[model samples]
Target: MWFLPDGAGITNWPKGPTELDALVFGHVFTILTTPLPNNQFAGIVRGYDNLIELCKRVEKDYFEKVLEH
Candidate 1:
Protein backbone atom coordinates (compact mmCIF):
# COMPACT_ATOMS: atom_id res chain seq x y z
CA MET A 1 0.00 0.00 0.00
CA TRP A 2 1.08 3.56 -0.65
CA PHE A 3 0.08 6.84 0.92
CA LEU A 4 0.58 10.00 -1.11
CA PRO A 5 0.20 13.14 0.91
CA ASP A 6 -0.18 16.55 -0.71
CA GLY A 7 2.60 17.53 -3.16
CA ALA A 8 3.97 14.02 -3.43
CA GLY A 9 6.02 12.86 -6.40
CA ILE A 10 4.75 10.95 -9.42
CA THR A 11 8.32 10.25 -10.65
CA ASN A 12 8.32 7.22 -8.42
CA TRP A 13 5.07 5.80 -9.77
CA PRO A 14 6.94 3.35 -11.92
CA LYS A 15 8.41 1.87 -8.79
CA GLY A 16 4.96 1.47 -7.33
CA PRO A 17 3.28 -0.85 -9.92
CA THR A 18 5.26 -3.74 -8.53
CA GLU A 19 5.66 -2.73 -4.90
CA LEU A 20 2.25 -1.42 -4.01
CA ASP A 21 -0.54 -3.79 -3.19
CA ALA A 22 -3.00 -1.03 -2.33
CA LEU A 23 -2.33 2.61 -3.14
CA VAL A 24 -3.93 5.23 -0.94
CA PHE A 25 -4.16 8.81 -2.10
CA GLY A 26 -4.45 11.01 0.94
CA HIS A 27 -5.64 14.60 0.99
CA VAL A 28 -5.93 14.84 -2.78
CA PHE A 29 -8.00 17.99 -2.71
CA THR A 30 -5.73 19.50 -0.11
CA ILE A 31 -3.07 19.77 -2.79
CA LEU A 32 -5.09 22.33 -4.68
CA THR A 33 -4.46 26.04 -4.37
CA THR A 34 -7.69 26.43 -2.44
CA PRO A 35 -6.85 24.04 0.31
CA LEU A 36 -9.52 22.09 2.07
CA PRO A 37 -9.92 21.78 5.80
CA ASN A 38 -7.70 19.28 7.56
CA ASN A 39 -10.72 17.26 8.56
CA GLN A 40 -11.84 17.17 4.92
CA PHE A 41 -8.65 15.51 3.71
CA ALA A 42 -10.13 12.12 3.07
CA GLY A 43 -8.27 8.99 2.00
CA ILE A 44 -9.38 7.02 -1.03
CA VAL A 45 -8.67 3.32 -0.77
CA ARG A 46 -9.28 1.00 -3.73
CA GLY A 47 -9.35 -2.76 -3.71
CA TYR A 48 -6.99 -4.93 -5.71
CA ASP A 49 -9.40 -5.48 -8.60
CA ASN A 50 -10.28 -1.81 -8.92
CA LEU A 51 -6.66 -0.74 -8.53
CA ILE A 52 -5.48 -3.06 -11.26
CA GLU A 53 -8.29 -2.00 -13.55
CA LEU A 54 -7.64 1.67 -12.90
CA CYS A 55 -3.95 1.23 -13.62
CA LYS A 56 -4.74 -0.56 -16.84
CA ARG A 57 -7.10 2.16 -17.96
CA VAL A 58 -4.57 4.88 -17.16
CA GLU A 59 -1.88 3.03 -19.08
CA LYS A 60 -4.17 2.45 -22.07
CA ASP A 61 -5.60 5.94 -22.26
CA TYR A 62 -2.77 8.13 -21.04
CA PHE A 63 0.58 6.41 -20.77
CA GLU A 64 0.67 3.81 -23.51
CA LYS A 65 -0.08 5.96 -26.56
CA VAL A 66 -0.48 9.40 -27.99
CA LEU A 67 -3.94 10.84 -28.58
CA GLU A 68 -5.09 11.90 -32.04
CA HIS A 69 -5.86 15.55 -32.15
Candidate 2:
Protein backbone atom coordinates (compact mmCIF):
# COMPACT_ATOMS: atom_id res chain seq x y z
CA MET A 1 0.00 0.00 0.00
CA TRP A 2 1.22 3.51 -0.81
CA PHE A 3 0.08 7.09 -0.34
CA LEU A 4 0.46 9.82 -2.98
CA PRO A 5 0.52 13.54 -2.43
CA ASP A 6 -2.67 15.40 -3.45
CA GLY A 7 -3.71 12.31 -5.37
CA ALA A 8 -1.12 13.32 -8.01
CA GLY A 9 -3.53 15.83 -9.53
CA ILE A 10 -6.22 13.18 -10.05
CA THR A 11 -5.11 12.17 -13.51
CA ASN A 12 -5.14 8.90 -15.39
CA TRP A 13 -1.51 8.22 -16.15
CA PRO A 14 0.50 5.45 -17.71
CA LYS A 15 1.98 2.71 -15.60
CA GLY A 16 5.70 2.66 -15.01
CA PRO A 17 8.30 1.23 -12.71
CA THR A 18 9.63 3.19 -9.79
CA GLU A 19 12.37 2.27 -7.33
CA LEU A 20 11.88 5.01 -4.80
CA ASP A 21 9.12 5.95 -2.37
CA ALA A 22 7.60 9.14 -3.76
CA LEU A 23 5.31 10.15 -0.97
CA VAL A 24 5.40 13.61 0.58
CA PHE A 25 4.96 14.65 4.19
CA GLY A 26 2.16 16.63 5.84
CA HIS A 27 -0.44 15.17 3.43
CA VAL A 28 -3.17 12.69 4.30
CA PHE A 29 -4.58 11.57 0.96
CA THR A 30 -4.61 7.86 0.21
CA ILE A 31 -4.50 6.95 -3.47
CA LEU A 32 -6.00 3.82 -5.06
CA THR A 33 -5.38 2.80 -8.66
CA THR A 34 -5.58 -0.02 -11.15
CA PRO A 35 -3.40 -0.89 -14.11
CA LEU A 36 -4.81 -1.39 -17.57
CA PRO A 37 -3.81 -3.91 -20.20
CA ASN A 38 -2.23 -1.26 -22.37
CA ASN A 39 0.19 -0.12 -19.71
CA GLN A 40 -2.10 2.74 -18.73
CA PHE A 41 -3.35 3.50 -15.27
CA ALA A 42 -6.74 4.40 -13.86
CA GLY A 43 -8.07 5.77 -10.59
CA ILE A 44 -6.58 8.61 -8.60
CA VAL A 45 -8.84 8.74 -5.58
CA ARG A 46 -8.13 10.77 -2.45
CA GLY A 47 -10.01 10.09 0.75
CA TYR A 48 -10.25 11.22 4.39
CA ASP A 49 -12.89 13.93 4.28
CA ASN A 50 -14.58 12.24 7.19
CA LEU A 51 -11.35 12.32 9.15
CA ILE A 52 -11.34 16.10 8.98
CA GLU A 53 -14.84 16.22 10.33
CA LEU A 54 -13.92 13.78 13.07
CA CYS A 55 -10.98 15.92 14.08
CA LYS A 56 -13.21 18.99 14.29
CA ARG A 57 -15.66 17.11 16.47
CA VAL A 58 -12.89 15.88 18.73
CA GLU A 59 -11.48 19.38 19.10
CA LYS A 60 -14.88 20.79 19.96
CA ASP A 61 -15.52 18.07 22.46
CA TYR A 62 -12.11 18.51 24.05
CA PHE A 63 -12.52 22.23 24.42
CA GLU A 64 -16.00 21.90 25.84
CA LYS A 65 -14.93 19.31 28.35
CA VAL A 66 -11.25 19.74 29.16
CA LEU A 67 -10.77 23.43 28.60
CA GLU A 68 -13.64 24.18 30.90
CA HIS A 69 -11.78 22.67 33.80
Candidate 3:
Protein backbone atom coordinates (compact mmCIF):
# COMPACT_ATOMS: atom_id res chain seq x y z
CA MET A 1 0.00 0.00 0.00
CA TRP A 2 1.04 3.59 -0.54
CA PHE A 3 0.26 6.43 1.81
CA LEU A 4 0.79 9.82 0.27
CA PRO A 5 0.40 12.77 2.59
CA ASP A 6 1.83 15.52 0.48
CA GLY A 7 -0.41 17.17 -2.06
CA ALA A 8 2.43 17.77 -4.50
CA GLY A 9 3.81 14.24 -4.38
CA ILE A 10 0.38 12.68 -4.47
CA THR A 11 -0.46 14.73 -7.53
CA ASN A 12 2.64 13.49 -9.27
CA TRP A 13 2.21 9.85 -8.28
CA PRO A 14 1.16 7.27 -10.87
CA LYS A 15 2.88 9.12 -13.68
CA GLY A 16 1.94 6.38 -16.15
CA PRO A 17 0.49 2.93 -16.66
CA THR A 18 3.34 1.14 -14.95
CA GLU A 19 2.93 3.19 -11.81
CA LEU A 20 -0.80 2.79 -11.97
CA ASP A 21 -0.36 -0.96 -12.19
CA ALA A 22 1.85 -0.90 -9.14
CA LEU A 23 -0.70 1.14 -7.28
CA VAL A 24 -3.42 -1.33 -8.16
CA PHE A 25 -1.29 -4.25 -7.05
CA GLY A 26 -0.70 -2.51 -3.73
CA HIS A 27 -4.48 -2.66 -3.25
CA VAL A 28 -4.73 0.15 -0.71
CA PHE A 29 -3.61 3.75 -1.06
CA THR A 30 -4.39 6.95 0.76
CA ILE A 31 -4.09 10.61 -0.10
CA LEU A 32 -4.29 12.62 3.07
CA THR A 33 -3.71 16.25 3.90
CA THR A 34 -1.54 17.22 6.81
CA PRO A 35 -3.67 17.60 9.85
CA LEU A 36 -4.20 20.81 11.78
CA PRO A 37 -1.14 22.80 12.87
CA ASN A 38 0.47 21.66 9.69
CA ASN A 39 4.21 21.93 9.56
CA GLN A 40 7.23 19.84 8.77
CA PHE A 41 7.07 18.28 12.20
CA ALA A 42 3.44 17.24 11.86
CA GLY A 43 4.09 14.79 9.04
CA ILE A 44 5.21 11.98 11.30
CA VAL A 45 2.17 12.38 13.50
CA ARG A 46 -0.16 12.35 10.52
CA GLY A 47 1.65 9.39 9.02
CA TYR A 48 1.41 7.48 12.26
CA ASP A 49 -2.29 8.18 12.50
CA ASN A 50 -2.83 7.07 8.93
CA LEU A 51 -0.91 3.86 9.50
CA ILE A 52 -2.78 3.04 12.68
CA GLU A 53 -6.09 3.54 10.95
CA LEU A 54 -4.98 1.40 8.04
CA CYS A 55 -3.87 -1.35 10.39
CA LYS A 56 -7.17 -1.31 12.21
CA ARG A 57 -9.11 -1.62 9.00
CA VAL A 58 -6.88 -4.37 7.69
CA GLU A 59 -7.16 -6.27 10.95
CA LYS A 60 -10.92 -6.05 10.92
CA ASP A 61 -11.09 -7.19 7.35
CA TYR A 62 -8.74 -10.06 7.98
CA PHE A 63 -10.76 -11.30 10.87
CA GLU A 64 -13.96 -11.05 8.89
CA LYS A 65 -12.45 -13.02 6.03
CA VAL A 66 -11.12 -15.67 8.37
CA LEU A 67 -14.49 -16.03 10.01
CA GLU A 68 -16.10 -16.42 6.63
CA HIS A 69 -13.78 -19.26 5.70
Give the range where candidate 3 is weakest over 10 consecutive residues by summed lDDT.
25-34
Q: Once all C-alphas are superposed, what RMSD does model 3 give against the true structure? A: 10.4
TM-score of 2: 0.26
Indicate which candidate wins on lDDT. Answer: 3
Per-residue accuracy of model 2 over 1-69 as CA lDDT, tens digit each: 023334657475435312222232112222222344542221222344443433344446444687777
Cα shift from native, residue 34, model 3 (Å): 29
Q: Give the candidate number with the greatest TM-score.
A: 3
Stretches off by above 4 angstroms in model 3 are: 6-8, 11-47
lDDT of each: 0.38, 0.35, 0.45
lDDT of 1 by residue, 1-69 (tens): 233332455555544433332232112222222434653322232233444454454456555577544
- C-alpha RMSD for every candidate: 11.4, 16.4, 10.4
The clash count for each model shown is: 0, 0, 0
Q: Which lDDT tens digits does candidate 3 get at residues 1-69?
A: 333334534455653235543453233323233344555554544456544454445546545689876
Clashing pairs in 2: none
Question: For model 2, what is the C-alpha lDDT against the true structure?
Answer: 0.35
